[model samples]
Target: MTSKTGAHLRLLGVSLLALSIPMLSGVAHAEDASPGASTSDEASAQAKSGIAEGSDILVTATRANELAPVTASLQATQPQSIISRSFIEDSLPATADFNQIALISPSVSNYGAANGVGLSESKAQIRGFQDGEYNVTYDGVPFGDTNDPTHHSNTFFPSNTVETLIVDRGPGNASQLGQATFGGNINMFSRATREDASAEIKGSYGSYNTWLLRGVLQSGAIRQLGGAEVVLSAQHIGSDGARTYSPFKSNNVFGKIMIPIGPDAKLTILGTYNENSFNQPDKDGATLSQIAQYGKYFSLNNDPNSQTYWGYNHTHKTTDFEIVKFEANLSPFATFDNRAYTYSYDNETLSGSDVTLYATASAADIAKANMVTLTPGGAKTVGVPGYTKTNKYRVYGDIAKTRVDFGFGAITAGAWLEWSDTYRQQRDVDLLTGNPNYVEKAVKDPVTGIATPANIKFDQNSNTNHTEVFAELELRPIAGLKITPGFKHVNFNRRIDADYNQTTRYPQKLSNTYTVNLPFATVNYEVNPALSVYGQFARGFLAPPLSYLYVADPSFSTIKPERSTNYQAGAVYHGHNLSIDADVYKIDFSNKFAQDLTAPASQGVVYYNQGAVQYKGIEGQVTYAFTQAIAVFANASRNYAKTRNPGEARTQVANAPEYTAAGGILYKQGPIRFSLIDKYIGRQWFAEGEPDAYKSNGYNTAILSARYEIGPVRIGLEVNNLFNAKPVTNISPGKTTLFDQYYYQTGRAFTGDVTLTF
Candidate 1:
C-alpha cells in the first residue's frame, strides 16, 4: 500500500478503537465481578436504575432497538447499509428524494446544483462508479430509461412512499437482476398498508418559494375481501428554484392493496402516476466570464430577443408505474413468488441552442452567420433559434422465483424477462413563431434504393428485449456458517428503425444481440449473537450502451461489453452502546470504452475499448449511543481508481472523489427530536483522458433539523447548508470560448412543515 493509503487505514483504526473503549471497559468489569453475585439480579438492578451492565448492554430489547440513521444488518452477506423509515420521518426534509436520503451513507456523493434538493434530476456516484454503472430497484423490480440504465431521481417514487433503503456495495448474488450490476445496488421498498384505518393531511413551506401539500387515507382490514388492506395518497409540490428563471412543479398519486388468499398465499397490487413540468435553459451552467458579468445564479433572462429566454425553454413529462405480485407457500419447505409490472415515461421539451453563443447576437446576425433560417424559403424575422424534442417509451416485464428448503440447505432460482418500445425525435424550430426551420437534404435509402427529401434532424424508433436466468444454493454444513454459490446468464437484443439517422441523416435499419454468463460466491460466519464476518467473490457484466450502435456501418464496429472481477470482505459488530461495520474491496475492470475523437464527421461518433482500470477502497461506519436519548454517528471512505494502459502512467478517474466523510449528533426523547449533520467530499478531476484536466477543490455542507409532537399533530423545521458554503461542484468545457462553465451548490435554505393525523 502507498503511504497515503497506510495513513488512512491507521486513522480509521484509531477511530474504531476509541469508539470501542467504553464497551470494552464495561465487559472487563462485568467479568471481574464476584462469582457469588447473581448476574441476573445485578443486571435487573442496573436496568431499574437506568444503568446498563457491559455484558447486557445490547442484550435488552430497548438498547438493541435504538434508532440509527444508517446501520448494518447482522445477516448481510456483503457490505450493506440500511436506512429505516423512522429516520426519514425525523431527520430528512419532506421534499427529499432517494438521492437526498443517500447522502448520509458512506462512499456516496451528490450535488444537486441550482435546482436544490429534489427539485430536479440529480446524478449520484458510488465509490468511483458513475450513474449508469450501478443498479437501482423499487421493491424488487428494476426500472430505468430504455436507451441506457440511468435514473431520474425526482420523477419516480418520493420519500413519503418509501419504507426502507439498502445500499449494497458489491455485485450481489446471482439472484440480483438489472441492466447494470457491477458497481452496486440501491434497493428501495414501499411502505406497507396499516392494519388500522387512519387519515392524514400534511403541508410544508420552504426557502426559494417552495411549498408542498399532501393527503393520505388508509382502509382497515375488511372481512368482505379476505381481510384486505388498502392505502391511497396524493400530493402536489411547486418551487421557484435557486437559479434565475427556473421553476419546477409536480403532482403525484399512489395506491396499494394487499389481500390474503386462503391461509397460505397473499396478493399485492400497487400503482403510481405522476406529472412534472419545469422551465430551464438549454445550457445548464454558466461560463466564468458570464458568471463574472452577470452573477453565479445567472441562467436565463426575460428578454424575448435572446436565446436564453425562459419562455422559450421548457419541458413537460408524465409517468406511470403499476405492478401485481402473488406469493404462496406450496408446502412446509417450498415457496413461490411472481410479479408482473409495467411502466412508461413521456417527455416533450423545447430548448434553445447554447445561451452564451447568442448572448449578445441578434436574429439577423444569426441568419447572416447561417446558424438559423437555413431553408430556401424560411423566414429570417424569427428570433431565438431552438428545437423541439420528444422522447416517449413504455416497458413491460415479469419476474418469477421459487425457493425450497431442506434439512441441510436451501435452493433459490429465478428468471426475468422484459421488453421495451421507444420513439424519439428532434427538429429545429423558431422559438418565436413555433415553425420548423429544417435543413432540406436529399438522401437515398440504402435498402430501398429510393431518394427522398428530409427536413428534420432525426426521427427513430427502437425496441429492446432483455432476459436473465439465475440459480443459487445456500449450504449450511456446520452451525453458525453458510456458503452460497450461484450463476446467472444474461442476453440482450436491440433493434432500431430510423427514418433519419442521427448525425449522418440517412434512413437505416439495424439490430444487435449480446450474451454473457456470470458466477458469484459468498461465505458468512457468525462468531456470536453480536458479531458476524463475511467474504464475497463475483463476476460482473454490462452490455454496450445504445449510442454505440449509432455508426453508419454496424458491421465495422468492434465495441465489446464491459466486465469486472470483484473481491471483498467485511465485518459487522453490534454490542451494548455501539454498532460498527467495515469492509475493504478491490475490482479489476476491463473492456472500458471511450469515444474516438479522430473519427470523421460523416461516420458519426465511433467508440473503442480504451483499456483496463483498477479500483480499490476502504469503507466503514460507526454509531454509539451515550444514553437512551442521545447518540453520535460517523462514517468515512477512501477510494482509489486509476486507468491502466500499455505504456502510460496511471491517472485518476474523472468525477471520482478521493475521499468522503460524514458525522453527526442525534437526540430523540419523549416527544422531541433533533440532529446536526455535516458531509465532506474530496477533490476530483472534471475531465478524463485530457491533458491538464481541471481539478475541483473539496467542500463540505451542514444541516440542522428539529421536530416536536403533540397529540395528533406533528411539526418539523430544517435548516440546510447552515454555514452557507458555496463551492464549485461541476464543470463543462467550452466548445467556442476560452472559459469553461461551472456549476455550484446552492446556499443556505430553510423548511418548516406540519402534519395532522386522524
Candidate 2:
C-alpha cells in the first residue's frame, strides 16, 4: 500500500463518518434508555452530580473500602476482573503496554518483548486462548486487522492513553459485538478529560538506554462552548533494547474535547495519531552452539552489508484514530447513548532473507565468504532485502444503544454497523541497489504517482462489512435473585475484489457472507449485600479471516467459521476490609484455526482448520487491608486446553501456559508509597504431543517500587525483574532439538520517573 492511497482512504473514511453523525443523532433522540445502559464519562459525571448532598449516598461512602475488587467483579454476570489506574501506576512501569497490564489479572500471560514496551514483540494469552482468539475493544469500539480480527499492539493505543482495564473472562451480554467474543473481552477506557484546568509533565529513564517524555494539558470548562472542556497530550519514547539489534522509537499525539449538549446530555470527541519505526530483532532462539558462541541475545547476522544486519532490518507503522460519542438522559427512567469512530493503520515491514539462488550454502557461510572478499565482476552476493508486507486499511463504525427502566427490571437494545477497506501487498527488493530485483516489468501506480514493480509477490484489495442488532432484558423476580436473557443477530460480508500474484499473472476475486444468531442467559443471586453468586451460558461465533480469500488455492474459500459455547459460574464476597472473587469457566470451541509457523515469511500464511478444542479454567483473586496503611493482593488461575482430534500428534494447545499467578504488597503512609510485586507463570508448550524439548520452563519475576510526593511534584523509581531471571518465554521447534528459533523474556531492568503538575 502506498502513502497516496492511504491518504485518500483516510479522507474518504472521515467524510463517511462525518456524514453519518446526524443520522445517528436522529436515531438516539427517537429512543430512550433500556436496561444495562452503556456508561460513558458524561454519564459518570451526571451520576456524581446527581447524588443528594448529606443523603444516604454520602453514608454509603463509609462502605466503599469494603467493596474493593468485589465492587467491580460482582456487578458482572460472568467472570470478570478490573484493574484500576492507581494499581496500574503502582505495579507497572509508566511505559508498560496492555499485555503487561493484563498480567495483573488471573489466567493472563504476556510474553515480554526484546525491547521493553515494544508491543510488536509481545503476545498475550487468556485462559489458554491465543491473541486472536479473544476480543479487545477501546471504549466499546472493537479495533483490529480486518483480515484476521487480531490486533497489532504496536499500531494502536498505548498504556498511557488508557485510564482503566476491564477483563471479562466469558462472553459478555448480547450488547458486545466481535468476531472472537468466545474467549472473552478486554475493554480499555481512555483517560477522561480533567474537570479542572491543569498541566502535567512526565519523564522517565530506564535500563537499556530507554527513555520517555510526555506532556498533558487540560482546559477546564469554557462558558462560550456550553461548558466544553478539552485535553491535549503528546509523548515520545525510544529504547536501545534489552536484546541486541532490537531498538524502538515512537511518537504519539492525542486530543479530546467534551461538551455538555444540554442539562441532561453530553458530547465528546477524541482523536489520536501515532508513528513508529523499529529494528526487527531475531526471534529464533539461539542453538546450543550459538548460545556458547554469542550468549543469549544472539541474532543471525552482523555484517554491515548483510540483509540481517541490525541496520537493514526494520519496520515502520502509522495509525490515525478518531471517535465521536453522545449520551443523553431522555427521562428519569431512560437514557440514550451512541458513538461513531474512524481509524486507519499503515504498516510496511522490511526484512532480509536468504538469497534463493545461492541457498546451496548456509547463510552463515555466505556471510563469511562475502565479508572476506567480494567478486571482482560486481557487488557481493548479499541476502535479499524486501518488504515483507505492506498493509493499509481504513475502518468506520457506529453503535447506538438505549436503556430503559421497567417495573420488574430493565431492558436494553442496540445495533452496531462497521465497514473496513484494506489494501495489501508484498514484494522483494535488491539488497545492494535498494531497488526491486524480481520485477519482471515496471508500471506506474495511478494513486502513488511512482513506478511500481509489476511482479508483486502478493497483492490484494479487501473489504468487510459487519452488522449486528442485540436486545437484552434484566428481570428481578425476587429481592435477591436476578435473571437476564439476551439475543443478538450478526451478519458478516467479506469481499476480496482483487488478488494477484506475479507467478500466475492472474487476478482472483472471492466473496463470502456469514450469518448467525446467538443467545445468552445469566442468573445472579445477591445472597446478601456482601456476597453474590452468578452463572451464565452463552454462544458466540467467528467469521473466517478475510486473508484466507487471497490464498492462491481456490479451495481456501471453503473454510468454515469458528464457533463456541461458553459456560461460567462465579462468586464474590465484599466485606468491611476484604474482598474476594472466584470463578470457573468452560468453553467448547469448534472449527479452530491453526497456522504453520515453520513456513517462511515470503510464502505468506498457511492456515488449517483444527477440528475442535475444549478449554476450562478456574481463577481467584483477593484483596485485604490489614491496616489503613497496609494492604495485600493476590490472584491466580489454572487452565486446561485440549484438542479432540485423535489423529493429531499433540492434543494440548501450544503457546499457552498451564497457570499464572501474581501477588503484591502495598504500603502508604503520608507522602510515601511502596509496593512489592511478584509474578509466576507455569510451563508453556511450543509443540504438540507434549514434546519436552519444545517447551518453556516458566519463570518467576518480581518488581519493587517506591514513590514520594510533595506539593505538586511526584517522584518514583522501580526495579523490574529484580532477580534478573533470563527465562525462555517462547521456543522455536527444530528438526532435531528446541532453540532452533525463540525469544527470551527481558531481563532485570530499572526505571525512574518524575511528574510535575500545575
Candidate 3:
C-alpha cells in the first residue's frame, strides 16, 4: 500500500466513524448501578472524579499498596488502548473463555488467529517487534515457551477471570527476565476475592457463518478466612471460516484459585486446558489468470462484481494444543509463575505453485474433472512440510520481593531464578506412502545407505536455565516528585541435543552462549494533583534475531545481543469531565540480528547481530464525558523507524504502524448502551529495496459495536473490518516465512450477541 492509499483510507474511516457519533448521542442514562459499581461511597466519589482512576492500571501493574494516585500514567497501565472486560464480553474469540485480548495496546498489535491453536499459542507482536521476541508474565513472573507451543503464553487465566491488564512498552522492567527483543512485557492479574461473587454468560453468532458461546463462574470472597477466590470458565466456537471452502472449530477451559495469606499477602494456583482443532485455510492473493482476466485476485465464473473462491488464499491443517500453569502471589510485594505446555500437529501445507497456473489449468480441464492438479515438480517443501510435530515445553521459576515505606519516600526490591526446557520432534512423510517424504532411488549408489531421506527429520531436545538478580527503588523525597532506578544481572546457558535419525549417526550436542548486566532508569515530577510530567531514559536488549535461533549453524556464532537506548517524555492530566495523555519517544537500536547474505551459499544462513536502527515517535489518547450518559474518546500515535545508516534498506523489524488514529463515542441510557469506534492505521513501508515489489504496506481497519439491555439480559451487534481492509505484508530477503505478502485480514462482518449477568 502507498502513503496516498493509506491516507485516503484513513480519511474514509474517519468520516464513517464520525457519522455515527449522533447515533449514540441520545440515551436515557440508567441510574440503577450494577452491583460492585460505585455506591456513592468514598471509593465511588474518587472513582467518579477521574477516568484514569477507574483504570486499575497501577494496582494491576505495580501492585500498588495504596489507593489511586491523582497523577498516574494512563499509558503506564497499557500505554495504549485498553481491551476492557466489557469489550471482551462483546466480541469473543475462539478460545474466549481462557483468553485475554492481546496486541490491544498502542505498542502491541495482534494479527493471527487461535483457530487451530490454543490461548497459549496465539501469536502477537509489540512495539515493532515479533511476538517471538517477547517476555510474558502471569502476575509478574517469567512467561514464555522455549519449544513446546512456541509463542503461546495467553493461558494463565481466562478473559473474564482477569481483573486488569498492564503493558509496558520497550524492553521490560528490571524485574522481567527472559528473551525479549523490541517487544515489551504484558502483565496479567488474575481475579482476586476482595469483593463478592459474579456470574456471567454470553453467546454470539454472525457473518461468515460464525458463532460463539462462553460462560464464567467465579467464587468471590473468603475475606474473613484470609481471602480466597475461585474462577472457572469454558468457551466454544464454530466458524465457517474466513475464506473459501474453509470451516473451523475450537473449545477451551480455564480455571484457577486465589488464596490469600493476610491483608498484605496472597497465594495463587491456576490451570487452563484447551482442546482445539481446526483446518488451515489456503493463502489469499491474486492468481495470474485472474490478474489478466479481471485484475489481481479476481473471478470470472461469478458475476463481474462478485468474489470467487479461486482468489482466496488457502492453508490446510489439523492441530491439537494444550497448556497448564501455576502461579504464587505474595500480596503487594512478590510473585512466582511456572507453566508447562505440550502440543502436536499434522498437516499437508500445499502451496499451489501459482494462482495463474492453477487458474489456466482448471480452465483447460473442466471436462476432465473440475479439479486442481499439480506437477510433481510444482510443489516445494513448505514449513516442517509433511507435518508431524510434537513439543513439550516448561518454565519453572520464582521471585522474592520486599518493600518499605518511610515518611519521605518508599523503597522496593526483588530477585528471581528461572529454569526452562523443551523437547521438540518433527518429521515429514510422503502423504501416499506414509514414509519419510522421499524413498531411496533404488540405484547402485543405494549402497551408501538409504540416502538421508529427501525430507529429513530434524529433532532437538534442550534445556535452558537462567539465573537473574534484580532490584528497583522509588524515592519520593517530596510528596509529588519521585525517582526510580533499577538493574538486573542475568546468566543464561542452553544445551541442545539434536539428531538426524535418518542417517543413523550419533546425536549432536551443540554448544551455547550468553548475555550480561542490563540497567535502566526513569524520573517523574508531579507539578500538580491533576497533572504531571515524566521522562524515562533506559537501555534494552534483544537476542540475535529469530533467524539465528531457528536456523542454527556453527558458521553463525558470536551472535551479539542487540542493544537499545530509549528515551521518552510524557504528561498525564485529568479534569473533572475529561482526561488526556501524550508522550514522545525515541529508540536508538544497534547490533541488529540479520542473515549473513555476504557469506557463500554453502555457508547456510546463520543469524547474528549486525545492523542498527532508529525508532522514534509520539502517541496519545483522550477521554471526555459530556454527561454521565455520554462519553467520547480518541487515540492517536505516530512513529519513524529506519536503518541507522542510509546504506541499509529492508528488514522485517516488527509491528510498527507509522500512524494510528481512533475515535468513538459511548452512550448509555436505561439498559441500552451503544459504542461506535473508528480506527485508522497509516501506511507502513513493510520491506526495504523492493519498495515496489516483494513487500507489504500498511492499511487502516475499523470497528463498531452497540448493545441494548433488558433487565439482566443484554443483546448487542458488532461490525468488524467495516471496510474489508487488506492484509499488509513485509519484504523478506528470500524463502522467509514472513512474506512480502502477509495473511489477508478478516473482511467486514456482523456479530449479534446476548449476555446475561446474575
lDDT over C-alpha atoms for residue 564 of model 1: 93
Could you give candidate 1's per-residue lDDT for residues 694-714 as a string of tens digits?
A: 786788878899989898998
For candidate 2, the TM-score is: 0.85
Q: What TM-score, to 2 decimals, does candidate 3 have?
A: 0.74
TM-score of 1: 0.89
| Tens digits of lDDT, candidate 2, 51-78 | 1100000001113232232223333467
lDDT against true structure, model 3: 0.47
Q: Candidate 3's residue-wise lDDT over 1-758, tens digit each?
A: 11221121111011111111000000001112211221111122111111111112211121111111111242142232334444444333323432225533454455544222131134555555556555654444445555421354433344544544445555534544456624555555444322457887988788767787888886766555544666778777677655334455556676765554433223445555544443332333434444455542232232111123322222333333333333332322233333343333333333222222334435343222222112222333321113345555556665554434343544445555666566666554433233444322221112334334334345666777667666656566776565666677767666666554212222556546566787766666656645667666667765542224444255455577777787877877655566677888888888766666776656545555677877778877666767656767776677666666446664434445556666666665567666666656555544453254543456655666678888889888877766766553332232432222233455577778888989
Assess each prediction's global lDDT (C-alpha) against the native: 0.73, 0.67, 0.47
- How far residue 446's Cα lies from its native spot in candidate 2, in Å, is 25
For each candidate, C-alpha RMSD in Å? 9.6, 9.3, 10.7
Superposed Cα RMSD, model 2: 9.3
Rank by lDDT, highest first.
1, 2, 3
- Supply every candidate's count of residue pairs whose N, Cα or C atoms clash at under 3 angstroms: 0, 12, 19
Model 1 CA lDDT for position 69: 74
